[model samples]
Target: MDRLTLRLPPDLVRRFDAAAAGRGGRSRFLRRLMEEAAQAPLPAPVAATPAGRTGKLTLRLAEADLALLEAEAAVLGLSRTQWSVALIRRRLQRRPQLTPPEAVAFIEVQRELRRIGVNINQIARAMNTAVLEGTVLDLEVAQLAAFGDEIRAHLTGLRAAFEGNLAYWSDGT
Candidate 1:
């Protein structure tokens, strides 16, 4: 790997950092960008189309956002505009139509479920590390096992709550 130093404008740097934060870190983000650029299809000429075949929509993005879009488009073997249109269409098509209050409640439930999952992961990791170190006493292992059971109970409740809502809209609900 080669190391390169870049001197970018402060505002651009801020935007880049923000984008990188969403994707783990700067190095991974830049590596993905380079890979995308390497694999991008050659730009093709735009041809005249029949009337009403398609319409144009223009957007102005931060440099960081544009780079991300370009990378994603490259991965999909699509032009940036085509990729954006496809993504937007899929989002609109797939999402459920919920009342504002129902939407809020659904999002809250999802967030809580995610939080519980994270907590469960942390507890499992701690138990695994203790076992690997050969320091987990019998009583401590039993406690951890009990805690795991409790996490399973919470997960069951969350699943029941989600099912009770009966708001599966994607499959022609």
Candidate 2:
């Protein structure tokens, strides 16, 4: 490959480094960006409507904020505009928005809770059958109690995760 050198401002370099972190470093990230840009079709210009809406808005962001936005959007596989619009809608609707990682965590927690529920249900059915047959199941009662404790702990952890997510959105962080 041919070598090319370009000089960039220190602040710009810092932002680039921050955005490139965990993305296979600067070179790979830059190359992927270049490839995407090359393949992406140019957006057509928007014409003004008679109602005077051009459907265009612009914002000036600080370098650090821009870097953070780009990093987050990249992680979610979304464009900055998409991310911003979702955030705005979420805020306006007073709804919580979870990142992909957060969503995955919640999904795993839900699966565990479901599994626990199934186990509890099976234990209850077995106990009911034993009772109907005039037999006592001491072991099953102990197991059911243990399962109840386990479910309580899981629910507590799940509640904490939800509260943390809510706090994050509440603070706009």
**Top candidate, metric lDDT:** 2
Give the per-residue lDDT of model 2 (tens digit) for 1-173: 87667779999999998999989999989889988998999889876567844476677899999999999888867688877865775678777667777788889988988998999898888777666332357677778889889889988998887777556556455
In candidate 2, stretches whose alpha carbon ends up further than 4 angstroms from where it belongs are 1-57, 71-83, 132-136
lDDT of 1 by residue, 34-62 (tens): 88998998688888897879677879899
Clashes of each: 0, 0
* Runs off by more than 4 Å, candidate 1: 1-96, 132-173
Q: Which candidate has the highest TM-score of all? A: 2
Q: How accurate is candidate 2 locally (lDDT)?
A: 0.80
